[model samples]
Target: MEVVQVLHMNGGEGDFSYASNSLLQWKVISMTKPIVEEAINNLYCSSFPTSLTVADLGCSSGPNALMAVSELIKAVEIIRQKLKKKPIEYQVLLNDLPGNDFNTIFKSLPNFLKNLRREIGGDVGPCLFTGVPASFYGRLFPKKSVHFVHSSYSLHWLSKVPEGLEENKRNIYMTDNSPTSVVKAYYNQFQQDFSLFLKCRAQELVDGGCMILTLLGRRSQNPASKECSYIWELLGLALNDLVDQGIIEEEKLESFHIPKYMPSPTEIRIEVAKEGSFVIDSIRVSEVDWKVSNNNEVNKAKSVDESLKGSGYNVAKYMRAVAEPILISHFGEEIMDELFIRYREIIADRMAKETTQFFNVTVSLTKPK
Candidate 1:
């Protein structure tokens, strides 16, 4: 499968678009705010550039894209205010897959610029923003052109599905029941993808340039940790249900798999060390526990059924925005409504019994002088 073709958030301002259901991503931006600040601060402390070029890799459309850029510019302004230096010109690049919704991104730029002007008036210099349509697996900028790089919740996606993965007949990603070959295939793919990622950035980033990446990762050394594995497992289960009901073919489930892998902290460290492009500045693992969009209403509900239904409805919508395009590509667009109806029921039922959380691994690295 061509990731460039199938991998993009649902587009348009419609109810099912990623623009409509990205609160979870927004929350992730909020969680990684400090790391963003820290990276910007490091950039400032390392011979602050008179004119800086910053890139946000895999910056998907929606509120979160601008939010990340806003925080970055805020960091720069804060440093300038303290030192009382001349205004610094900035060139900001928003990058995503070629098929990304660049139109929606451009549509919101005027307001973003207007709001930006409100925040840091005359004190800051002129700013230029451009959308770069491409993947980050290779060089996207000139050598030593970028001062800092930031990515969030995007690196977990592999450049391509791992080879030799056909053995995992029942799983979407590495799961408790996944064979050792499946686990090895995923791990090897991650190593290749991440090393290429670092190498590309190493060439693009100036010496001492800092890069901060926040991605879905596992806390436990085990590949099957629920923190990162359960969602796909549950989705696989939903697909299985469709198969049992004869709504979809069994072969579709066998061939269809999510192109995401959640790496462990140890795996990350090992790969970073072997790549030998940058030095690790800081790496942190944080847990984000699942919660219904509105707990107040959930508690107010009189029946357990209502609460579960509500929880599942919101989550299913959220997941659908991000996952719909891929599912539609393989399974056909006709079954999306039905597929997610069952998905929501499964999620709600699971949530009612237990709380789920995802581990976000944030790493700040700097190119050596």
Candidate 2:
């Protein structure tokens, strides 16, 4: 079965726009810095070149990538200072899809570099930064070129939509009560994409290189598990309402899915082990509370109220971003406002039931020495 190539939604930075939010900076620092430091230390201990090259796969626009790069440089400097070696040149590669907002990233780079230079007082050696526009599942650099690779909150996205989903005209995802057939298909697609990702990364990394990845994940293998986020369920309900009102046809909605898969940490370990190129180093699981700001909450509530007040058109933008694109294509933007309003209320209710959000898994791995 051929995979469907749905139009990419959620834009370059992925949902939640972490790149632009200052509150998110600390999250990236705490999660990414130590893993990168470990990778660099291993490389240095192995007598790898002092000039290290690193790649930040799925690096989107804005300050987040730069922030990560800065931390990496500092970690490398500390390692060098401890070893009493002179500073060495570093080459950093930032990669994302071709259509990503490179303009924003380019605009942010110079200022970031200026700040870094001032902080280190020009002691940090030559640091080269460049952007590579290519799919992470394909070859984007020369063999054995990357010393360390890192990705955060990006790998959960499937390389392509599942096969037979578009052909069978079935929703790519289903709720807890969804049929076994639908769930099985989704799992199979995830398995395939994950295997491809491992194969691709294996080809890119040097013999002893390391990859540190953090993504949304589930703790259970049960397809009926409700551990999946309620945000998705609310969005599905909104889309169904639109379909009921004849604002959008069912066919259009079936063409797209959420493009997310939450695999268990054990499942991930098995896949990586099967690929036989990477050894699992560590796994960390934690709950990430992703509450929007008060302003956003207020605005969302306002939008919902307006839609409920017969101005359903006003909430389309919010719903469209959260809803399946196929629904938007068929509905023609008429019922989006109402859909969003209803969706927000449902999500808020769910949140009230559970104040702290639960679930995420981080896995650190290394290629054989």
Best by lDDT: 1
Ten contiguous residues with the weakest lDDT in model 2: 1-10
The TM-score between candidate 2 and the true structure equals 0.82
**222: Cα error in model 2, Å:** 2.0
Residue-wise C-alpha lDDT for candidate 1, range 1-369, written one tens digit per residue: 787788999888787888887877788889889888987987886786789898999999988878888889988888887888778898999999987898998899999888887887666787798899988998899999999899998999988888887878856677888899888888888889999999999999998898989998988888777889998888888888888999888877788778888887778889889989999888889887655343356667789889778777777887898888888888999888988999988998999899877788888898998
TM-score for all models, in order of appearance: 0.96, 0.82
lDDT of each residue in 227-336, candidate 2, tens digit only: 65354665776667666777667876666566667778887988887878899888877665534222243445555444233222222233343233444454455765
Predicted structure with the largest TM-score when compared to the true one: 1
Measure candidate 2: CA RMSD: 4.9
User: TM-score of predicted model 1?
Assistant: 0.96
Error of 2 at 193 (Å): 1.5
